[model samples]
Target: MTNSEQHTEHSEHHTEHKHIVEYGKYLFIWLGLLALTGITVSAAGINLGNWTIVLALVIASVKSLLVLSIFMHLKFEDKVFKIFVWVAMLTFAIFIFFTFLDYSFIR
Candidate 1:
């Protein structure tokens, strides 16, 4: 084979290797998150008073992280992308907090 053909083949192989590794890592993370979801649901049914919501939220946040990092490929993305995601999350939190505050303090 010509030199150019050989180089192309090598580059393709490298891309395939990276893709396979990423897929395997994401699969493992997804399976673990699924198991955690089951646990969270079970815990929620046990009547933990206020803590049930907290625990469920914590578990959901973890699952969101896995989905963002693995399924969305954010783990390998640029810092700016991550910052944008954080900003969006902060905005959502602010909206929810203010809504809760308004509801709790209404006359």
Candidate 2:
């Protein structure tokens, strides 16, 4: 084959390698998150008072982060995207906090 053809082949191969690496990383992350979910569910079954729900939610949040970073490919995304995600999370947190406050203060 010509030199140009050889170089093109090498470039394509390099791109494929990078894609495989990314895919493998995502797969590993997904499996790990799934395992964590199972553990969290089991932990919830145990009696832990008011802290049980909080712990379960925290674990679910971590699992969500794994899905976002790996499955959704947010890890390599722009900072603007990260900011938007954080803002949304903060809004949800505020909503939950206020709801809990209202529940606690109810007569």
Candidate 3:
């Protein structure tokens, strides 16, 4: 093979080496998600004013993170990718915060 072709093949093989997650880890994540879902449902039945929404949001966020890391394979991604995810989440939170602020003033 030519030098350029050899270099391309080598780089491709190098990047192909990725983390291999075990089945047990996936099962655990799935089970945790189910438990969180159950808790959220149970919490919904009892009213706690504003805290109900906050509690639901917190649990949803945790479940989302678990899905992102395990199901989406973000756990094996690079640091930059993880940072990007956090930035996106922060931006979303900021938007929600502003929206709530605007809503509260209207009431």
Candidate 4:
């Protein structure tokens, strides 16, 4: 058992354990994203005023989470990476909140 042979075997074993998502599941996710987009567009047409923006943001966040979890394979990643993603999302939310606050004060 040479060093190179052992390294190759270890890598092969590691790759075998990786989770592979099925194509059907991806298709469903795609459909869900499309439906959400349609809902966002339709909601924008209504006269909800300020709440419309909030509704759109919520829908967009859900779509983003779907993409991040499935398309980006974040769901299969380690806990540390998942925590980092959540932290980044939280930071983004804080920035958005501050921007809205500033706009409210200016108005």
Q: Which stretches of candidate 3 lie over 4 Å from their true place?
A: 1-14, 105-107
Model 3's lDDT to the true fold? Answer: 0.84
TM-score per prediction, in order, is 0.75, 0.68, 0.77, 0.75
- Candidate 2, 1-107: lDDT as tens digits: 11222232345334211222356786788789889989898998999999999899889888988889777756656566789999998999999999999999995
Q: Which is superior by lDDT, 1 or 2?
A: 1
For model 1, the stretches where C-alpha displacement exceeds 4 angstroms are: 1-21
How well does candidate 4 match the true structure, expressed as C-alpha RMSD? 6.5
If both were scored by TM-score, which would come out higher, candidate 3 or candidate 4?
3
Question: Residues 23-88, candidate 4, lDDT per residue (tens digit)?
Answer: 999999999999999999999999998999999999998999999999998887766679999899
Go through the candidates in order and give each one's C-alpha lDDT. Answer: 0.77, 0.75, 0.84, 0.84
Which of the numbered candidates is closest to the native, going by highest TM-score? 3
Clashing pairs in 4: none
Residue pairs whose backbone atoms clash in candidate 3: none
- TM-score of candidate 4 to 2 decimals: 0.75
Given candidate 2, what's the lDDT at residue 30? 76
Winner on TM-score (1 vs 2): 1
**Model 4 lDDT vs. the true structure?**
0.84
Give the lDDT of residue 70 in candidate 1: 78
The per-prediction CA RMSD against the true structure, in angstroms, equals: 7.0, 8.0, 6.4, 6.5
